[model samples]
Target: MDGEYHPKSEATVSVYDHGFLYGDGVFEGIRAYNGTVFRLKEHIRRLYEGIKVTRINLQLTKEQMTNAIVDTLRKNNLTDAYIRVIVSRGRGNLGLDPRSCPKPSVVIMAEPVAPAHGKEAREKGITAIISGYRRDRVDGTSHELKSLN
Candidate 1:
């Protein structure tokens, strides 16, 4: 994390990031409701679990990350919002190998969002389509770990 607040338009990540190159990263989607961050600890725990699985050496402790989330919210003067926390493999030379990356980049964004689907859809049910492609199994590639790509 850069430790500075930037406007959404000004926030930028390096093109050399391994996350952008090879999708080496993890993320969590969080919500703030009624002035409280819903399931904050659970979200942090899941994020750490992903980091452990990906073997990304995040310099900040879990508690610090949690505080950072709060700080970001305070800086933005927001409540009742959606928060996206992303930790991506840091910048490195152009190569598929992650060993070239020495750090991880963290970004947290908060914004207001209304429901995308209508209430009638929930009540009447929505159509579904099945695809031939399937996700990689947990043993092969953990679905629990969220990748930016």
Candidate 2:
């Protein structure tokens, strides 16, 4: 759905949407703690960076998007939850051409999510090591859009 809020069961995007058709889009996962959206500005900034690198001409500015998120949380009466902001290239033909899609679509979804592990698990803790695998090729389709801070 474009800019309107809809029930989860009613929310949908066209099959021809480039985002669905060819993975032509980007998104961000954010969280809210208590009554505040955590690192909201940073999330918006990073989201915009993705939008910039993907060349998606969003109809709303960063301020508007932030307002939208806050409004959504208010409407949902959610203070603590997981949030997802998804921007997809709108409907298009079968081809992989960006021009096929004129406008982009945005969807913001929020839901209460429990911690991945309970207090017992947290107390037990776990150990891990960083993966040596690199997800991108510097000379190829690297996902780096902005310099890491």
lDDT against the true structure, each candidate: 0.85, 0.82
Model 1's alpha-carbon lDDT is: 0.85
Whole-model lDDT, model 2: 0.82
Candidate 2: residue 138 Cα off by (Å): 9.2
Q: Give the TM-score of each candidate.
A: 0.79, 0.79
Candidate 2, superposed: residue stretches over 4 Å from native? 115-149
Report the C-alpha lDDT of model 1 over 20-76, residue by residue, as the tens digit.
777888899999865678999999998998998888889989899999999888888
Misplaced by over 4 Å in model 1 are 114-143
Which pairs clash in the backbone of model 1? none
Candidate 2 local lDDT, 11-124, one digit each (tens) = 888899888888888787889977699999998988898888888888899999999898888888998889988888778899988998999988899987666677887899
